[model samples]
Target: MDVDARLRELGLELPTPMTPAGNYVPAATVGDLVYLSGAGPLRPDGSMVVGKVGDGGLDLDAAREAARLTGLQLLAALRAEIGDLGRVRRVARIFGMVNCAPGFNRTPAVIDGCSDLMVEVLGDAGRGARSAVGMAELPFDIAVEIEAVVQVST
Candidate 1:
């Protein structure tokens, strides 16, 4: 599909790709699969969404938005690595982590923000295996962090 066109159709634009927080590269490719490192919710200006997400903390809806933003960052990294989103043949997997208050159990629901965006952008090719879990903390205290694996056509 025309991935760049699809983002505009959704009224979304990719932010500048983020640099790695540490010594790791943002993406690595082996054969046709590109593995993305975790990405946080970085705003267009580069500030991050930081907080614990859950009851009496950051609102779930806001956390979901953070996840979506994180997803956008992942896409940015993916495109940077692969040259074009059209190179993606399938979204193979995702690992999502949410920094949350104690006892929050809706990790999957919150991560759907990213999942939904993938499906919206790539249709069925974006449907992929996923795991979402709550965490006590994440790098920079970001509300959500997501990593992805995508299969691309050579």
Candidate 2:
């Protein structure tokens, strides 16, 4: 299926790409590899979803949702850079970070939210190497953050 069709089938619409909060660009391409800057769960209105997994009333499910949102933001950046999701040959690597309370160790499960969405939207091309790590804290105290590398057709 085409990228737009797949997104419609999943009932998802890409948000506008966000401007970088700092000096870095949202995405940069080197040859066929596109590296996306770390993204957080920012709503369209620009408010962030903030919390720590396993603490302050947040839980696994919430963190997973946050990860999914971060993934969407990454996609938004990719689209902004390449202008066509169809040009993506494969998702290459993803690094996920989850802000967690002490003793929490379910980072992988949370990051699966992002991984599953990528596969759902792009099929096998979305499968990739990944790492999920826990963070004591994150910018904005967001529940999760993710960065991605994608291989695109030249």
Candidate 3:
């Protein structure tokens, strides 16, 4: 099946591509690779999803959900730029930042939120190396932020 159909099968909907909030583009292409800038968890209504992982405000489970949402938004941005998700050749990497309490131990699990979605949509080929780090704070104080490198069709 195609990308749209894959998403439909998974009951996922892409959010509107969010404009960069600062001095950066949402995504850029260098050769055939698209580098997506960090995308914070954004609600369907276009509001930031705020929290810190492992804190009472946002635990591991909540952070995972946020990462998943951010991944979908990233794909939405990709489709907005390329006009079709099928143009993606493969996912190269993902950088995940999770705002969390000092002792948070589930960074990998939180990042799985995004990873699982990529696997679902792009299968094994979409899997990529990932970095999941805990930070004292993140842009907009959202639970998670995701950036990616994707190889695209010519």
Candidate 4:
């Protein structure tokens, strides 16, 4: 199936590409690799979804949703840059961050939301190594943020 079809099958719609919050571009390509800057959860209407996971300020479930949303946002960035998902060969790695309580230990599970969706959309090729970490806080109080590297057709 095509990328659009897979996305629809998973009931996800990509949000519009967000402008970089700082001086760097959202993504850049080097050879066959596309490196994406960390993306915070963005609602479909362009507003940010703000809350910290396990902070009592946000629930775990919501954080997972935020991660899933972040994945979609990354895909949107990929599409905007490359013009198509078919150009993607494989997702190489992802780094996920969740703002959390000092003792919270569910970082890996929260990041699974993004990992699972990548596999759902791109099948086996999407499977990749990942690191999930907890932070005292994240920019804009976002629940989750993620960045990725993928191999793409030249």
The CA lDDT of each predicted structure is 0.92, 0.91, 0.87, 0.89
Between candidates 1 and 3, the lDDT winner: 1
Candidate 3 has an lDDT of 0.87
- Alpha carbon lDDT of residue 46, candidate 1? 72
Error of 2 at 88 (Å): 0.9
Clashes of each: 0, 0, 0, 0
lDDT of 3 at 85: 91
Sort the candidates on lDDT, descending order: 1, 2, 4, 3
Measure candidate 3: CA RMSD: 1.1
User: TM-score per candidate, in order?
Assistant: 0.97, 0.96, 0.95, 0.95
* Candidate numbers, best TM-score first, in rank order: 1, 2, 3, 4
Model 3 Cα displacement at 143 (Å)? 1.0
Residue 113 Cα positional deviation in candidate 4, in Å, after optimal superposition: 1.0
Which has the better TM-score: candidate 3, or candidate 4? 3
lDDT of 4 at 83: 88
Best by lDDT: 1
Which pairs clash in the backbone of model 3? none
Candidate number that wins on TM-score, 2 or 3: 2
Candidate 1: C-alpha RMSD to true structure equals 0.8
